[model samples]
Target chain A: MLMIKTVLHFDSVSFRYPKQEKGPLIYDSMKFTVREGEFVSILGPSGAGKSTLFRLITGLEQPTGGKILLNGEYFSNRLGHVGYMPQQDLLMPWRTIWENAALPLQIKGSKQADMRISVEELLKEFGLGGHEDRYPAELSGGMRQRVSFLRTILTGSQVLLLDEPFSALDAITRLSMQEWLLKQWEKRKKTILFITHDVNEALFLSERIFVLTDPPVSRMEDIPVPLDRPRTLKALDIPEIMVLKDRLIDQLRTKATT
Target chain B: MKKWREHTYSFILLVVVLVLWEAIAFNIKMTFILPSPTDILMKLWELKKVLLLEHLPATLCIILIGLGISIILGVGLAISMNSSKIIEKAFYPLIIFSQMIPTIALAPIFILWFGYSIWSKVLVTVLITFFPITINTYDGLRAGSNDLKELLLTMGAKKKDVFLLVNVPSAMPHFFSGLKVAVTLSVIGAAIGEWLGAQAGLGYFSRRMMTQFDGAGVFAPIIVLSAMGIMLFLLVKWVENKTLMWRKSE
Candidate 1:
């Protein structure tokens, strides 16, 4: 039997605000893992610690207890080890699309010539071929998100954390973006941990859905979707999938009380 | 059309006011007391060569040099404050306190220290004008939340990288706003400094005319100085528009 490689692991991690402001612990001895090239969606309701988990992963907030391992090795500093795509399409207003895409490379001090060539290729691949000269305001919502994603990818990390990346888009645009993201995940083979509140979005995108039920979330109910590869919206219409979706939704709704 | 109409109204108001002043001056019949609009205008025309070529240039020289120094110092101070919380905590209150003491009160001290030279006038300009630049740019630097900086930091960005990418660009709009205020104040600062003590400059020339009871002559330099201030302000505005062109395009 071939053993899957765990690309990221939260080893008994715990976090509470240093101020201890009003609430119980946000997370108590939480643990999770992402396998190489696997896409995982963390499903939860609003005001849950989903984005906070990403922040800990990104080293914006440090864990009070336990180690965050990347590729089975712990680094004291976890920053720049993963690509983080925030919910907002935070394309710099001052930069053209090309310059925005080139930002990560520029920040990392890559050679200007190499940065230009690489940025050009990524721009073309991302379907931003001729629109490089335009500013963020000129682009549609979907296009701006794509540029944002392209910049995240340029961070040159094997792991990517997407925080509600498609929540702001319209329904049609969100579906298309989901499909595009899935395709990109497969092509890039990067380990992805996506955060979303939408149950359908979680089901459509992930091989596994980790349900973050409530605060002081020591454990998440990790449910494997058991779907075949290269999924479609049509795949979700099956009766068994419907049953699972309803069960998950019911679990989500009542979990707050429990 | 509405804006054009408003400007025309202002022009008509000025004409009415000047006519009233002319009528009043004729009634008073005191050339030394309140010169008529026509008399002031005539004196302005006659003194055009001296005012424009000599006094105007001297005043312009002081304003330009003083404003230039203020720009450099203001940017440096703003950046220094932005880079560290400790510096901000220490200097921010001091900067505010410095503004409390009047620039007129400070001008005499500058003259006492630097002794009626260009340096004294420039120092006074800097004192009056640098505060706006420092405070506004500092506020602009602090405008964005830590999210953007953290975003860059997660990309393996060093301190310099973060400053270049986020801090600098974010502060630019605020910097320009401060600059517009500073440019207008710079004219007042320079003139005041020259007023307290100077052989040349519009302020000195105007004061000299007043002592001689040449009311029209005093008013002539006043007009020249107003023109200078308006011109400087417009120039600064044009530069601001050019530099922040991205803001408008968006």
Candidate 2:
């Protein structure tokens, strides 16, 4: 079997806020790796420093100690190697869906004509056809999220980091979005590190899940879901899924209490 | 339909006010103190040649030039201030202090310096109009959500790209809002400057009329000035609406 390269690696990372010199560390000697073309989800409780990890990866914040390697290259406090979708949609209210999605390409100094063509094609594939002229306010929440997601993918990065992308969606919409995302991931074959607090979501989407304990994230449990490809809602009914879900939940509950 | 109703109501109120004015003027029998609407209209028609030919052009020229200068300078200053924390810290207090010195009080000084020329009036208009635009644009530029800025930075966007794409567009609504106030004030500023000292303008003409106790003449230019103010305000509003079509007007 061909070896899948690691797209993102955190080698014994440590971080703490500057203002809180005496406070408890947010991360202490954290370590993880995401393979190329794999869907990996980071599952943790609230206030578990998941966002801080994302900031560090995106180069928005610098790690106090340790190294972050992207595509086998170490980058400290630098951005633009990975695609990032923030927790909020963050679509400019003044811009249309097409313009908003085209922003990444525009920033890269792509020709307007080329940007429009690519963005339009992607919008159609995202099931947002014929909504090119509509502003952010006119779109539904789910549609907005899809537009945001489309924008992230258009950035042309090999790895994508989504920070709780569907957290604000209704349960039904969130489920549908997850399925849609999985379909997109399979087609694109890009390395994706998804962050979510929900155990079921993590199980349903990722091949391997990183269950992080609350802050100072000193240790993590990596659970592998040996499920078949092209998963559905019916995957939740499988006996193995149930067993893993209970085990993961018990682990999280115990960690939370302790 | 709603707009039509509003127009009809305004017309009715205007007619009621005019009728009351005519009744009061007739009862007092003092055209010098309070001219009847007919007297004012007659005077407007009589002086229409001089008013439209001589004074209106001068006033319009001064107001437009003043407004143009204010917009360019205000927007420039706002962008500069927004780009640097040091500039913002240094200039913000001075800008506020400038506003405290009433433009009306300084109008005479401008007139003295510029010697009753159109420049004095333009300066007054600039002084009156620029502050709001600068302040509003500055606030708008700074008001961009941090998440959006961070997202842009992560997308490999340079600082210039962020300013042009995010800050400039975001500042537009506030710019238009400031323009509305500035446009209305431009008329008053021009009038004040002309009133202080001017060879020819509606303001100068009105002052002459006031001194001569020609109530109808005074009232004619006053009506024209108010109309000019309203028309300029509406023009700014129309442009704002066209430019910011994404904004739903409440």
Candidate 3:
């Protein structure tokens, strides 16, 4: 089989926030590569700078050291190659679901006629076709997340960065969202970089997981998921997957104790 | 239905005030000082031909023209101020100073420059009305949460889009709040300006009656002026409700 090339490379990336003792260094000499079409989840505890990592990828924050390359080129805002789904949904309350989903396309100056068709397709695919006119407030948390997700996809970006997109939901809703998200990802096959503190979330969704430590820190481990493709809820009971879970749990527990 | 009930209370209060005024006026027997509401209404009816057709139109024109200019300038200046901290720093203090100076105090100066023409009244109204709009727009622009701003930036929202989509719309409620105050001020400003110097206006008519010791006539013009203000206020409120229908459901 032919090897897939790296789409994103974070080379010795280090970020130090200003105006703090020792500065807020979330990544120190951190290096990683996300292969084309890969779903990589950055998993860490709260304040571990997982969210900041998303900001870095989106160009909201620049790394103090090292470089970020997308598709072997220097990352630039002009690329418009990354779709970001923030934690809060970030839906404009003034706009209906259709309008909100259509916004990115509109901003990109896509034809208004095409926007309707494209948005409609995405909405229907995401199971939100009938609720087009409803405001963000009218939708449930899970539905909002789905709309936000579709919005990201509609940005026409090759890469999607999700920042705890499901953390706001209840457990039952979150599980359903996860299943839905995986299905969508399977269809789109876009490179995804997700940030979450939920170990099971990382385990359930990503093809690879990077466990990051606290401030002034580096990656604790970058482990390729050994689970098979087209995974289901039943796959969680696999002994090997359970062993992997236990190992990650132990890492988190030890880190907490220390 | 609930709002209609709320309106009824104010109506009842108005009726009580009118009844008390007529009773007290009749008991004391002084039509020259505090005319009965009935007497005032009769005078208003007799003068409606001239007052509503001529003086009322003049006052309405000045108020509308002044309000239109102020809203445009105020919202434009507010957007500019929000765009740059330097602009905000330079203009914000001056705007505060203008508010403190009081339009009434400066009405004479306006009369000196524009004479007894409609321009003078319009100028005064604009001065009185613009402040609240500027202050409210500024407040609205500043009200956006940091995360929301950052979210737009990350999503590739241009500076213009951020202002237009996020800032302007977010500031709308505050803008309307200021507009409400400005609408009332527009009438007050025009009336006060006309009171100081004018050939024709409700204020001019009221002053004419007051000097003649026609208390009923003066009260008639005063009531009409008040009704005009209320009418303008309700019109602005109607527009506000229509434009900001999204807010009402919330």
Candidate 4:
């Protein structure tokens, strides 16, 4: 078996917002690791500093103490190594779907003709083939999310961070999007760090789940999903998976109370 | 079909208004106090040669030149002001203060300084038109989402890329709205400047007609000036429609 290398490591990271210097620290010596090609979910309630963690990892904000390592190298507050999809679609209303998806490439200074050709194929694969020239206002919520996702992927980063990308969708659409994302993940094999409050989603998609306590997260528990590969909706009913789900819910409830 | 109906309704209303004016002029038995629409139209036809040869071109040139300068300077100032908080704080109050001083007050000063040439009129137009563009563009630039900015930053985008990609496009609607207001004011600005001092223009022509008590002649230039204002406004609207197709409703 090939050895799995650590793609990202959080070495006892600590952070406190500058405005609230005297307040409790947001991250108290937090530590974790994501292996190469792994799908991990950070499951926590709202205001658990989950977004703050992403901010630190994405280099939008620097950690006050400790360090973050990407591929065994010190990662500072610098962008471009990781792709991020914010909560909102954030598509430029003035741009067509094709133009919006090709933004990262444009930012990287790729030739327009080449960028269009490449983005066209990606749009087709993502079920946005005929909608390339359409404005964002014309697209449905799911289609817009797909375009945003395609834009994130086009950034060409090996590590992807998704911040509640489907929280805005209806239940039916969210399920379909989850299934589609799982398929995409299996095919791409990118290291994904997903942030969500949905336990079922975390269970269905990720190989491992990190349950974080409320803000000033003093502790974190990592639980592995020992399920078969190429999962389906049927996997949700598996006896062991149900047990794990109940366990996660209990942990979350307890954390909320305490 | 709906748009055509609306236009047809507008034409009927205009015809009714014109007939009413003609009735009133006939009852009064005087062309000076309220000239009939036909009298105005006939005067316009008689002065068409002078309008085309001299006044029309003069006014058009001043307005176009003033508008062009305003757009360039306005957008440039907006970009610089948005780029830094200190610069914005220093200049924002001064911009508002400039607006408070009526253009009428400044027109004579501009004439005194620049002389009775086209420069004074153009300068007055610039003074009136640049404010809307600058203020609207500034508001639009600042209205860009912080989330989007952070997303771009994470993509390793440079400061220039963020401004061009996010800021400029977001400012389009606001810029167009400002332009619509500015273009209408530009014609008025030119008229005011010409009222202060000028060798030739629709304003100069109108003043000459008014002093001579040639009511029909005065009405003729006023008609031409109104037409000029409408044409310039429509031109701006047409450009805005073409460039901002994204703003169209679904």
Best by the DockQ measure: 4
Q: Write the per-residue lDDT of candidate 3 for residues A1-258, one digit (tens) a residue.
A: 998978888889888875554756767888888898999998877777788787788888778889999888886552256788989898888778998998888778789789888888878878898988788888898999999988888887888999999988999999999988888888888999999878898999999998887677765478888888888888987999999999998887777777
Interface RMSD of 4: 1.2
What is the Å distance of residue A117 in model 1 from its true position? 2.7
Ten-residue stretch with the least lDDT total in model 3 chain A? A75-84
List residue ranges in candidate 4 displaced over 4 A: B7-13
lDDT values of the candidates? 0.88, 0.90, 0.86, 0.90
- Tell me the interface RMSD of model 1, in angstroms: 1.1
Ranking by DockQ: 4, 1, 2, 3
lDDT string for model 4 (B5-103, tens) is 879978999999999999999899778768899999999999999987899999999999999999998898899899999989999899989999988
Report the error of model 3 at residue B205, Å: 1.0
Residue pairs clashing in model 4 are none
Which window of 10 residues has the lowest lDDT sum in candidate 2 chain A? A72-81
> Which model is ahead, 1 or 4, in terms of lDDT?
4
Extract clashing residue pairs from model 1: none
Those runs of model 3 whose alpha carbons end farther than 4 Å from true positions after fitting are A18-24, A76-79
Return the TM-score for each candidate structure. Answer: 0.94, 0.96, 0.95, 0.97
Q: Model 2, range B41-110, lDDT digits (tens) per residue?
A: 9999999999888998899899999999999999999998998899999999999999999779878888
Which regions of candidate 1 deviate over 4 angstroms?
A1-3, A21-23, A256-258, B1-6
What DockQ was computed for model 4?
0.72
Q: How much lDDT does candidate 2 score?
A: 0.90
DockQ of each: 0.65, 0.62, 0.48, 0.72
